[model samples]
Target chain A: MKDLTTENITENVHAINSQCQNPRTRYIFERLVSHLHDFARETRLSTDEWMTGLDFLTDVGTISTDLRREMILLSDTLGLSALVDSIDHPRTGKSTEGTVLGPFHTHDAKEVENGYAIHKDPDGTPLLVLCTVKDTEGNPLGGVQIDVWEGDSHGNYDVQYPERDGPDGRGILFSEQDGTFWFKAVKPVSYPIPMDGPVFNMLQMLGRHPNRPGHVHFLLRKDSFDPLITALYPRGDPYESSDPVFGVKESLIVDLSEVTDPEMAKKYDVKEGTSLLTYDFVLVSTRETLKLRKEKAEEAIKKMGRSMEDFQGLPILDVD
Target chain B: MKDLTTENITENVHAINSQCQNPRTRYIFERLVSHLHDFARETRLSTDEWMTGLDFLTDVGTISTDLRREMILLSDTLGLSALVDSIDHPRTGKSTEGTVLGPFHTHDAKEVENGYAIHKDPDGTPLLVLCTVKDTEGNPLGGVQIDVWEGDSHGNYDVQYPERDGPDGRGILFSEQDGTFWFKAVKPVSYPIPMDGPVFNMLQMLGRHPNRPGHVHFLLRKDSFDPLITALYPRGDPYESSDPVFGVKESLIVDLSEVTDPEMAKKYDVKEGTSLLTYDFVLVSTRETLKLRKEKAEEAIKKMGRSMEDFQGLPILDVD
Candidate 1:
């Protein structure tokens, strides 16, 4: 009789592997199975532990809704989102590094002009954000689109608040003809992720905190160049290097300086604030395709993290 | 600046690891993060591919309900359930092997005496199952409780059908003083698992069928002995070796011979049945503790896959 040893599990894995019609799917499933079996062995996981893990995942799923996605949050806290980001947006010296697309980026925010008030909440310190989108060689590229979002003064996203279906602390902005854009907003602050669910329970059980560093999430793109996803971390945040999601990168951290230029304050419409945020996005054509360079880019464009049916493509500029 | 390379992901992993309060939780999370990172690197997954994976998991969670758990089934079809089974229920030459506790066991099935009709559908051939529960030393332990369940002749469980709140092709039977029990039912047949959701779509995409070997699930227990969970597979089934869940074992397979004796048929109250299924369950106490396995056996007694407020323990025997 064939026994149920570790070796036989490998044999079964191979048996299932052979049945996969898609080669990439087969590769992924085999690796997943092997790692899972190894994890079980490494932990010598008992029945209760196994059940606990299953229950945890079930609870994560059960709480998922149109407004909240616990699964992605699970992935984030587990450091999976960071790993996938590293793989997809590899450290090529030229392009900006990409980070996770946290489950708060919505598509309802229309494209605002170069200078718009992104954080209109009256409680937090007003800060101005000025960014110049450019190619790697320092050539200014106008009409670049950047989807920006961050929590308000209370450290909760627009969606986190009830009766707030549209973006208040989020916006879509296009660079000017000179490839420079600016906006007014509250300086984003560090915040703990939702800690009321099983994911948080697991973190608490592990003695870990659920805090993410303060940052503004930006999805920047221009046609013919690859998209760059990065969170502009407030420089000197305590959790910058110790983010629970492992999303910190030294290059992505930017410190905002207090700008007192009277003329500049009037230009950006942040009359009430003393300081502003400034960061320029340097874009490049990594020429990297999606899904292991095998899948069509369009295939990925549609599946991106938004319920918005139409992704407004890059605006065509007179000068390429 | 440190780049977002595999090395940096490791750095991020370390950053998160430093905050873990519990050593065991840290170990598990670190290993999980490391393996997940490695998987991403080995696959060089793209953004779109990553999104697809996330969406697949989200869909799995979206469909989960009181009646179905697609996440556990996903684990089963991928052989994770089997690996966990083998880990938690290791290969001991003395006891029966354990398999999955499929999401169908209900506490509604009352404990019946010997020679009960589990399958009351009245459409299929009658099956008379006779079994004896014994310890490793061949000692007949009287008053063994065995919870049995199986799909009906249509290859569906009562729960899978509408409005069937309790078990029909299921029973909780008490053994006679000689440690034997008999039940009448339809000979269970091999059937495909529920395949109308994302789990089935994954199997289909992998070119794998959703068939499980035909078997009767049994959860047997006595007061002092360790519990035994197993499935008695009918011999000669087409999907025996290729069970999609990878749950087949030669020792668990048994063939029921045809018994034409009118006298024996009358004894079990099954008239003119051509086949008789007999399998003696050798349930040795491979003692195991729970997660908080330190709990007395009584704690586990009530929570064995039932939604009951109380677990009716083993029927008191005449002699302890």
Candidate 2:
């Protein structure tokens, strides 16, 4: 029968929620309630302000659809998506770093062979993408699966155009015996995140831009290896540094240099001066990934001033 | 061009948001981002977990409509609504404390004279409500407008029954010259919050019961007095202690006793065993409310390790 003041309501909430049967759910909710209460208290959040926030969240949810996920966009703009990705997929032993899987990705990208051009139209600038997959020891690994997708030169994904018939600027390819895969696609251009939603409204209110850096998304997987979800931001995109989603990383940014050699163009069957993006991905085995994650979990537990036992029932990326 | 590791992302987010022109928006966002990132890092929130939360929020929003406000229900269940109410309307002196003005309040309550019965049917136990309003010095506050509403004996508000026409169990009344008011209404019974939404689903997951204590809502207003939005829970309700919305306070709980006096029941136009609930409300002037809020803001800022300058542009309830 405890009365709830602003000071004691947090603990009251925790005590009430402690009846949850799942330990991980309880622990996550405990921290979440603590931070939520702390945020309200620290800001001395007004009733009006609280209502405003709730309304914004509701609007974000209402505006979301299959083609547009405003909730994920909200997370991205607030940096939670990036934080989760960073924490979940920490780089280990020269492995490729992962970034947020932005909502634009679709599961139905067209599959193509090596040296195939994914673009069906000539509206976008020609770009030659050359990628290689290797182990942490720099040994080429053949037959790895690569899923690549990017916005067109005009900064719109195929999904953004309801009139478009099929996927464009995206393809699935398997690494050749030399651990190399080449594909010709449009050069991605910096694009504003969807503007007709509460996320963009929030960004405008915060004096922040909604544009993400020009980038290509890559999803790589192989047997017994940790999958890589990453993006390569073109080096000179204006929004590179202040990517609204915070998905950019130093190692993931790549230079797009022009290849003016007519011999190279003839060999690739493309026009001269086509841009070339060359990058090699280093993959980490599942065992190494597990070790790194365990170490990270321990470090995080120590930093949180909590024993590992407090997180006992929580999953630690149990890929097995 | 800072790399957004889990460690540096919080500050990077703050830096990017610093371009906000409004100091208050900037400050609020700074704290929000800090806590959001902290929650993610401390919990090591996974991508799947993040997506689950977003989906839950989306469902909550989708379930809401004009008659139902699941967002406010979310705030209430999470204790944020109560927290904000306590912060906004702290009790000063002997003034009555405020609680959440829940989403069921409608503006179209029928105006009635004191002692008028708000119920259109005879379906519940009769109750006589006697109320008086006074200032801090105990001076009677005549001509005060009091808006009162409550759930029926079946534990459903008028709004919850779509087929029911107009407002019942609710009325607007003005105090007599002696600052006294009386009314005949159904004795409110404990009721579950709307159970068809994500909030209820969350409560179920958290092992919580969704019932609120039997209560009546009062909204008091006058020319210079701070408007009071509060509710009175009947004593001895089983759910009083753990109101799902955390709206119950010891001071707000009232004694409801059976009154068997035939003369009294006849006078109040009710049965012999009608319950009687008598409570007095103390109102704080708008000036006092502002002063109290300003002091609270200062205390909160100090506790937040921030100076008053950081909150300079924010409104402090300037009723004038």
Interface RMSD after interface superposition, each candidate: 9.4, 1.9
State how far residue B105 of model 1 sits from its true place (Å). Answer: 2.7
- lDDT of all predictions: 0.71, 0.84
Poorest 10 consecutive residues by lDDT, candidate 1 chain A: A311-320
Q: Please tell me which predicted candidate would have the highest TM-score against the true structure.
A: 2
**lDDT per residue, candidate 2, A1-320, as tens digits?**
35788898998998999899877788789888999998888777877788899888888878777767788888988889988888777687488888988888777887789888777666888889888999999899999999998888778888788797778878899998888888898888899998877888899998888889888899998999988889888888888888999899888999888778898888778788889998999988978776776677778867876766434423332212
Please give, for residues A1-320, the per-residue lDDT of candidate 1 as tens digits. 13455447866766766777655566567667777776665545556667677777878877777678778788877667877776566445666778888877777887887677887699988777888888878888899888988898888987777788567988898888898988777888888888677778877776677888888889988888778888888788877766777777788888788777778767666574466677778776645433233332233323332121211221111111
> Residue B3 error for model 1, in Å?
6.5
Off by over 4 Å in 2: A110-112, A115-122, A162-166, A259-269, A310-320, B107-112, B162-166, B258-267, B310-320
Cα RMSD (angstroms) for every candidate in the order listed: 9.8, 3.7
Docking class of 2: medium
TM-score of each: 0.87, 0.92
Clashing pairs in 1: A128-A276, A128-A277, A207-B21, A291-B46, B290-B293
Instruction: Calculate candidate 2's fnat.
Output: 0.79
How many residue pairs in model 1 have overlapping backbones? 5
